[model samples]
Target: MAEFDDILARAADGGRIEAEDALRLYTDAPFHALAEAANAARERVIGDDIVTYIIDRNINYTNVCTTACKFCAFYRAPKHDEGWTHDNAEVLRRCGEAVDLGATQVMLQGGHHPEFGVEYYEELFSAVKEQYPDLVIHSIGPSEIDHMSRVSGVEVDEAIKRIKAAGLDSIAGAGAEMLPERPRKAIAPLKEPGGRWLEIMEAAHVQGLESTATMMMGTGETNAERIEHLRMIRDVQDRTGGFRSFIPWTYQPENNHLKGRTQATALEYLRLLAVARLFFHNVTHLQSSWLTVGKAAGQLSMHLGVDDLGSIMLEENVISSAGARNQSKLGELIDLIRSGDRVPAQRNTVYERMSVHWTPEDDPSDDRVRSHFSTIVADLQQKA
Candidate 1:
């Protein structure tokens, strides 16, 4: 107990904790003690007065994918009847709706269609920027970049540069399900290597684009492997320092190829959250994933070192297809944060506070700012 207390004290004081210390804290520390240490660490970096959320939309541009990852339920083979790609016009329409509902960021995410390469992204990104110049296009990840580069017969750096020139604001850490070889291969064997993911992100950072780091729990990965994921991210962050935040989400087991597997328990998720805060001394923000875990767990995470409530995902399909049905409205999200004894602030893609909700009166209501409206998926299903 004394040794654990000493480690916790050092971590709460903003000192770095090694991988072994993190393992002990994650596996052996009492729940309340771990939460206290993590909250203290968070307070030492980000103040405890406010929690943040984002108003963003996830636009799945296509469902055709060649990489048939074992854990994915969102993609269809290219020649499948259910596979569909949104025309540029429909994509623009979704962005318009998102903007009208006060979205500051649009995430253009989808599977890797062999026919769609870097040029496809360049044209789409440029069109979005030309129309909605203010919308932050924080979309895609290292895996997508790698796929696009390969399909276009270009180098990875060239692909990143072309997309950035076409108005990509930053990258999202989506494909980083796990960074260790054992678990990553077991879940996503066809996906790029974990080290390659980090290297592409490093190249993006060098080219002046920032990104977030993510890990998807409950993919049958061991606790040590979870810690290893964080270690991999932290090492890369040590050199590039381009990761603005670290987000960890749980895997949705229903309707996916990894079906019949149990999701990670809420307690495990909370423990990982605390450990992540203590481990990533270099990462600035930690986001709570209310979209994957239940709302109750997300609310409790506020006290366990989570400072961001991710987004009130205006529309989501990929995760929804895998059975994540939790939803939140604009006002409801603010109340969720405020109920945790923290003010709610709306932030842009870059973590800039756009508006701060200091009190109930400051909370705005917009029914159109829905948490779930999968028009694309619905339309596709109807057509099918």
Candidate 2:
């Protein structure tokens, strides 16, 4: 285990962590030991005793997906009667609700609607920005861009430019269900190729659009594949440095096609978190998957290596449709961070500091700002 110890030492000293070392840590390192090393690395890389959260909402504009992945429960078949797409007015109304509850950012995600193309998103984004000039539209990802390019008969770079010019703030790194070819095919066979996703992201970065990278683990991917995911993202970040953060979350197993047989355990999640902190030395922030992993696990992640607890999501549907039951309010998020013995702060989409909670007096009095209390799906369905 000298190799493992050496890797740990390197991480503690703020040195780079290679994929082989990360694989060993994932396979052999004790849970607590890995957490300690990762926490130390976190302190060196970002800072100790400070955890960040953002106030945002996820707006799934459509449930109709042409490329229905085996691991997804949120997407409806394109011709399925259950399929629904939000109109511009409904989209704006949700944005208004999110802004009313203190969300500065909106993640405009959706399934790959076959009929919609680049111009569709351009008009939607332009309309959103026209109405709500302040709300940051961190919308769509590589999968949507590639799909729209094919539909609109334009190149990926042109689609990204059109969306950016139409007020798309940044790409919401969702299409990366898994980076490796084998598992990516197993889970999301019809989505864009792994290399194509990275190429599109790099192209977007080249055009001045920064985005985060995400990994949806479990669904039967191996430990080595997990490490490989980190390696791919690290290589990209090394080249473009456009990735703002790396957020890895476990797969949810509810209404999905892949059932619950291949779920990643909580211990495994923590191990990956620690390895991520050490492995992603070039990445600026590491966020927990509290929305999928639950609050206790999320709280534990900060001590393990996560510098950010993600968002107090004003609304979410992707993972929720796959059985994410956990929810929290802004005050509760502050308490979750405080319980971990770390200071809590409010951050924007780009990790900019918005507010910090030092004491009870500094807390917001409104406890009703819940993370998952309101959802666009429920509101739209109820109205329909």
Candidate 3:
């Protein structure tokens, strides 16, 4: 196979690697060549060897979902015996645990509960903010916002505005499994359409709210469909410049409605990671998700153009409910980045540096910062 010399050079040199160009890299390019190109692009754009992580929690407020995506094992039907919704006080108590352990951001992601309209979110956000004035409410993506708008009999714009006014800090960009039709429909037919997700994201961006874009690959999506997903996000980003980071994670195949059909291998995941860093030139950050793909794979991503290694996720439920059992403590995460031979720094939702650990001595003493995926109220009070 011929090396993708020309394309690699183009991507590394600040040229916009088009969709077709990305496709070729995914298919024909030498694996290491693609990685090097991606790493070069990452350093060129973000600078230095400093990789960033956020001290955050993935909080699932309610598991009762109207959109029961086949790929999601976290959601429960409203009438189901196991269905549950955490009260605002419960949510607040969980946030307190996260904040005590050094978390600055909380990802309030869950399923689209049928009755959770704009007002529901408005109250939730308002209370969360009032209690934890310093914690950043990086909650809600476009799909949930669109669903809520319809539930409340309002427009997407109005839904977003009301939530933001109620102290929503930013969009989490969850639920963007795959932006193209084939794979999208194959996985999440009940969720809002893929294009509508982007539409809502752009609207939020226009209204001065920034978001991090995400792609959930390996859900029977072809390489072409994957590229198409990047294309869709890129097009929207060109317009609003709202995507602060691009995060690509593989699908978990446990306990979901899907047949557990096809999954992206580690190599394929690496290819996609490099392709994103190369293709998304306008995006400032590329996050490597260890929570979904294990710690080692996440570390490998640093050499393949990932500038951020995602979070020290204090709590998670969605991915775990689907059998994603990988775990990491703050010390282990720092070690993983160091094993990749890169420096690790703590970052906020917007990629602002909070703290940098240049050496082991710089590591924090708080070891209670492990992720807790408990749905029980009692477990939420107990620190990991």
Judging by TM-score against the true structure, name the best candidate: 1
Per-model root-mean-square deviation over C-alphas: 1.3, 1.7, 2.3
Rank by lDDT, descending? 1, 2, 3
Q: Report how far off residue 294 is in candidate 3 (Å).
A: 1.3
lDDT of each: 0.91, 0.89, 0.87
Minimum summed lDDT over a 10-residue window in model 3 is located at 373-382
- Best-to-worst ranking by TM-score: 1, 2, 3
Better of 1 and 2 by TM-score: 1
| Number of backbone-clashing residue pairs for each candidate, in the order shown | 0, 0, 0
Clashing pairs in 2: none
Q: What does the lDDT read for residue 27 in candidate 2?
A: 89
**What is candidate 3's lDDT per residue for 194-313, written digit by digit as tens?**
898999999999999999999997888889999999999999999999999999988989888875787888888888999998998899899878878888889899999998988877
Better lDDT candidate (1, 2): 1
Model 2 per-residue lDDT tens digits across residues 1-384: 565788898887778878988899988987777888999988988865788998888988899998989878889988898899999999999999889888989999999999889999999999999999999998899999999999999988899999999999999888898999999999888888888999999999999999999999888999999999999988999999999999999899988789988999998998999999888888889999898898999998998889999998888988887888888988888999988899898889899889888886787756768987588546655898
Model 3 gets an lDDT of: 0.87
